[model samples]
Target: MRSDSMGRQLLPKRIALPIFASDALSSVAYAPDEILLTLALAGSLAALNSVWVGVAVAAVLAVVVISYRQTVHAYPSGGGDYEVVSTNLGKTWGLVVASALLVDYILTVAVSVSSGAAYITTALPSLAGHEAIIAVTLIVILATLNLRGTREAGGAFAIPTYLYMGAIALMVVVGVIEWVTGNLGAAPTAHYDLVATGGHEEGLVGLAGAFLLMRAFSSGCAALTGVEAISNGVPMLRRPKSRNAATTLALLGTIAATMMLSVLVLARQTGVKIVENPASQLTLNGQPAPADLQIAPAISQIASAVFGAGSVFFFIITAVTGLILVLAANTAFNGFPTLASVLSRDAFLPRQMYRRGDRLSYSNGIIVLSAAAIVLVLGFNAQVSRLIQLYVVGVFISFTLSQLGMIRHWNRILRTRQSGEQRGRVLRSRAVNVIGFMMTGLVLIIVFITKFAHGAWITLVMILVVFLIQQGIHRHYETIRSQLRVDDWTAKRTLPTRVRALILVSNFSRPSMRAVAVARASQPSAIELVSVVADETEERRIRSEWEESGIPIRLTLLSSPYRNVIQVILQYVRTRRKRSPSEMLVIYMPQFLVRHWWENALHNQMALRLRRALLGVPGVVITVVPWKLGEDAEVEGHQLVNDPFKRPTTIPSPSSDTLVGPETVEE
Candidate 1:
């Protein structure tokens, strides 16, 4: 609700990187947990392959990042996946991509904050019981900060993001050093024996082992969750927006891939053991682990073992990693607004979402994103594991469709541009997108097959609902356009042959007098002071003054037996409209403008209702002549009468009837 200046909203690369890259970078905090948790289902042998799954996921990340870099260059308008699919695949698939990305952004906020809360409870046992509350609090903080503007939020969040990257890098370095120098030891739970569940204790075998590997691979694909955020937010970047965004995407890919793979390998090297049912699947010192024992996340356990538990370096990594996870949702804060703005421009979202706030941010979209994320947090009770099941499905859906759309886009371009280096570039870009689509499509199917019943179905349903809603909005807009279209330029718009100005006289005050003066200046052929006589005493006082003052305009009285001013005015308007539907019926509704918002409630109740009810009458125009309550309402009233801009040109005539009063003047 402030200045929506464009310059203030443009983000330089330094700030934009953090704005869009936070989610991808923060995935290192929890992606490992998911990978380890899923692999641990089949015991240690499957767990040993965690690093391999991470490698496969990182490869997909590489292809996706490359594909999206091409995307930003090709379509710099910030619609990202939605634009690509809509341009090449048609509006329906475009809506599907938008719906998937929209759902993905919401889940990113929920899953990131939930994972952050898990890290908090890991370091501080006292806060374990309030995870959902803590997660929602984090969402509120993020929404508030983001509403301040993208550049400001990026500035505020940049430090922690840098610190998190540094911390993770340091952890990896310290971990490798400890591993090389023979100083690293097993994690706190490394000694706990991991027992295979569902009678697979002997070890993974045959088709079942292959399926377990596939499931772990799908789980690890969570690392790719936030990779598309940079592409979705190209317009937010400074000049050369697409180039800067593509570079940021590359930076994100390198950092996220490096961190995810290193952390997984280190977690595996530290002999970190994780099981979904820790009490039943894990045994410590030859006895079943305590049923209520809290298992720290894989990142936490790795940090502890590598840096030595309780050390300053270890605590710093733990704190910043958690901070990064909370800030990871910042990516969605930037993404959803930009994407929603595009949707709004395309008539798929509310016009309000297209508006930038005084802070030059999409405040409405931010507020809505926060509300939805909070609902998810509350619905899942802030449990990271539960939310994770619903997490990557949306992103993968978007990834699969967006890449396919990009391929179509490049092919369409290749056909248009033949014989040159441009053709070569197009072919290369298409190849990258092809690889990206195939990789992501495979992961999407794997995720669907492995996690569908576990909660991915919920995300699928959500995407369908959003898709339908967007389609409805598009249809509604199309209908409005069809209804409003003009077929001929010479078509006539109706105008009154003779003006009839009805000045509503609520009381004999200066404000009412001003209304009569302006109406007379408008030079209507037929002008009358209309009033509903609620009380005979009030009516008598007005008529006595009317005769004494000798006001030239005729007064028309309507009897309101039920004291219902609005109904009486509506009846009069209806009758007048029926008598002269082709003529302009100008209803001069005078009002007093008060300074404060609450003062509005004190006045204008009748005038407001009169305006609303009379709108149904064809050819009726309600003109509000407002008198400011303080500091010369009468002077401004005369100004309203004489100001050329205030009085309609068609109404002003050379031989208009003059109002005989000190404030009324001949113009």
Candidate 2:
């Protein structure tokens, strides 16, 4: 599509919801499981606390959504947390937010795809051991879809997201009705007993138990990872963007929190057991569970109990759950690129990231995010449980900082207006942000403290590395700007003392003759055709042709005993510049224009090498004289031919007394 059609890409709330909130909403698939698994580390009885953990996580999710609603309305330029922090605090704090979000977005993809792979294997047990391979394949597919464009991806993924939501809601309603009727049966694994860790045999006692509960709560907070995506993507929304984005955030919070809490409540009622290590921590009858036991996730168990295990509804819910989990990465796919484009605009990243592709999407950022996620998935073997340990740290960091920035944002507004309805609203918003700041700040600390040893340190280190690298890039750009800044146009426009053209001649071919003719046309102070003598036979042919052709320009040969073409030519150019510092030296070389990729392999790329080496030399300029090859040389937008070397009417006087000839001279 043409770039002008970007306006057509603005997403309405229906499509925008799935595109931006799928990650947070799809957390229902695994967030409850994580809470249950962490609680099961104590004992079967202690696992019952999952309901309370789910409630805590849901409450936090609600507050974060409310806080970001204000963010979208106040700063709808799509900078999200980075803009909030940078505007309120400073650029350094903004960099902190950007680095955290970047790392978190990558982890979102890795965790979501890995969790999706786990669900797939649950349905098809035959594909159990190759989760990493399946996950990598899924990522490649997702990347391809996103490369097509954002609105198209949203359209492709919307049905599955809605179906997953409908499936979870249906299961919850069915489970509740069965409970009311006293017909809900226990899960298939409900009969197995959980054995607590060695130190927690007594269960939920002492400070250790309190610490364990905090860890479980932190694990459940993974549900909040994608809440900021809507705020980051405000620019992609249709008109009334802030209002639509806030509405979407509200919808996300309600649906995601309700689904998560319902799943945990259902798991508790139906006695679905999941543990960190199912083999050693669970027992059937009197012996440890079978070594190869496959523990279905909490949602699957809940579905099986609510609807018979063999029921079609159970498989439908399972399939949709797996698909939604994979589609959840689409949220990051949208957020990461938009956020990267913002950073790129601010000069914190490469300028390439700021340009849109043919699809009007940030293609570079999408490719980069996919590559990073694939590395994480492969490195961790696509184990959601293990990968979850490294999750949420960066997100909570961003959440905490964003809330604090929002609080400051409201305070600034209140100071500007007093004694009116606007002041009252500003004060209320400030109160909300203050609460959000406190809640998220505490959760951030809990996540870091609970998961640091497990793998959260890796996240912190990555954020630090990204921050330093961006700082270095910004500083380098600043240095270049300062160096290139022109203080006086008069001094900058001073002319060179003389212009000397040097033609790079290889043989008496049409390409070489064209180079000499173009150089002579320029009417420089002097023109000298030079060649490097790499082989004796080639050198003799060139010397014979130059004398026979009687080219107006003189020929000079530079002997290369080491057969290093580029170095020999550069040495001579530098020596000439050292002798006459104010004269401008223009080096012209012949180059081929190929019609096909393979045609390029037929000739040497000496001109390319020479241009690269000459670029860094002071007061030197290089030009390429193209010689078109292959059929269809007269392609539109490309010059078809060059003027033939008409022996120049007259040769200009040489700048120096030195006469040029074919005799070899050592540099």
Candidate 3:
């Protein structure tokens, strides 16, 4: 049982890197594309600015990564942005950030999986038009891997992540060397002339262009999506968790920024072109390119240019890039559950989210995140460009608020401080947080302004919806707590002076006889055999059997006009309770214990349903007198006595005559 309950396994650092860093790293695959696509609206000149935009994006990513490193060091509790914001800014801000992060994580999975499927379909033409199906399938598979356990999923991702890094690095090096040596040539689509869409063929410059530039920058900010995972996953790190996680964050940032910048530079150097509507906007030598010709992703185009078209190195780069994008969803798998566990601890989410599986991982969180991602993937048809618009808004929202919260946290800490050394440390940390706030706040404004119309509004709406739901959950828990509160007055109040035990009998069988004996032993004020009659023949047979058995207890029969036993019993109990409100009615129900799942089909569940309904009645108590079947009976007393019908030797049977009428019984 323990083994079955355990999570997949413990993840080593090698596996953890790909499992957590894939999102940040895989952004390199589409970061350049997003920049170029956004710039293409302004014609060739605007598109030419992709390299500078890439540089700016890399800079911001570096800052964010550094800021999060500090977060990991200070907190190291695996709460990430939600914890930081809530602890410092207050619960409202914390919940806001939590909602945003939740949506962002879901978008992460949707965007990554869809981008991966798109790349795969591009490489293998036979799989075209099946992008959504393929993307959903992959999501399901990844979810299963995660459900198995975190360590196992991480280990599964390790090789693909390293290969992806190695492939991209190789392409960057080879492309640069080839270009410098004059061996590199144009990409297959390099000569294609892109016709600007809409009326802005001249491309906007100055203020208009500046706005576009910010949009491009915001799009490129996709590179920073997974940087916070380290902060949320500090506990998953090895010894010296904070230090290791901080180091890992730095390494991830450096590598991701390098790859993103490399891809952008290479695309620019090789004259790679990407358009929104490739068939309509892209022309080859002033003629529209054939609709049948597929445009490869930005990274694949660079790989082919560097390694020569159709080369082994080109295929390797393409395969790993595609693989890494799919695995990038793993970062969300790592972050989402940990954050959910934090929210669960705070009562913002269901308590089950905090419980660990056999592997000591938040398995419930994994399932919830996966379900959310699947819905988004299906809703968006697995289109990366469409989904990318919703990507960074949530992340930056949290980033800005968390940094500001950190500032507040530092101020509060400083007020209680005494030592100069401690004060100096606090001041330095406060300085970093201040810088972080300004930087992230700027990026958040840019993201909202640039991406809101493109589809980000939907994401914001989702965040708000989630926020309301969380609030409702908190409210519900509070109401339940209030209702359950037991004060001294309530606790000291009387329970009951007497118990009226009713033995529910189906027939005058050994089981019913045993139930009567137990009920009598309880010494209730009133003891009676209550049986439900569904048909005349069965009722007469039961009555005759009772008389023949010579049981002294008076048998009371209730008619079930609709052939419903539970309803009849419920009505009878209600009538009794109304007559004597002070008396406690203990309904002893006879139940048979049987093995084999199919055995349940042979017996009616009326007793179970009846007990459930009886719970709502005041002054009513329901108890089950379980009659174990032959297979369920334990071997005892060296005889195969029908244990199901026979009373246990440990409990002495009561005399039937003493329990025949109403008489007050001691509590």
Best by TM-score: 2
- Which residue pairs clash within candidate 2? none
lDDT of each: 0.83, 0.89, 0.82
RMSD of each: 5.3, 2.4, 4.2
Residue 373 in model 3: lDDT? 90
**lDDT by residue (tens digit), candidate 1, 1-667:** 3464677778888788777888888888888888888878788787888888888989999999998888888889888888888888898888898999999999999999998998888888899889999999999999999888787788999999999888889889989999999998789889888878885554558777777778778878888877888877887788888889888988989999999999988998898877778788898787999898777777778888987889898889888989999999999998899899999998998889998887888999999999999999999999888888888888887888988898888877877948788898788888998988898999999999988988999999999999988888888988998978987656556445887888888665766877877777777777777777756686677677666656666667677767888888788788878888777788887887777988777765777777778777766788888777774644563564534234445554422433332121011
TM-score of 2: 0.95
Residue 14 of candidate 2: its Cα lDDT?
96
Q: Write the per-residue lDDT of candidate 3 for residues 266-290, one digit (tens) a residue.
A: 8988989888777787886777878
**Greater-lDDT candidate between 2 and 3:** 2
- Total clashing residue pairs per candidate? 0, 0, 6
**Which regions in candidate 3 have their CA more than 4 angstroms from the true location?**
1-15, 206-208, 418-425, 489-495, 509-514, 521-523, 534-542, 592-595, 599-604, 627-667
Candidate 1 wrongly placed segments (more than 4 Å): 1-14, 197-212, 238-241, 414-417, 420-425, 479-494, 533-554, 559-564, 593-596, 599-604, 616-618, 630-667
The collision pairs in model 3 are: 5-358, 6-358, 6-359, 7-358, 7-359, 8-149
Off by over 4 Å in 2: 534-541, 593-596, 630-645, 648-663
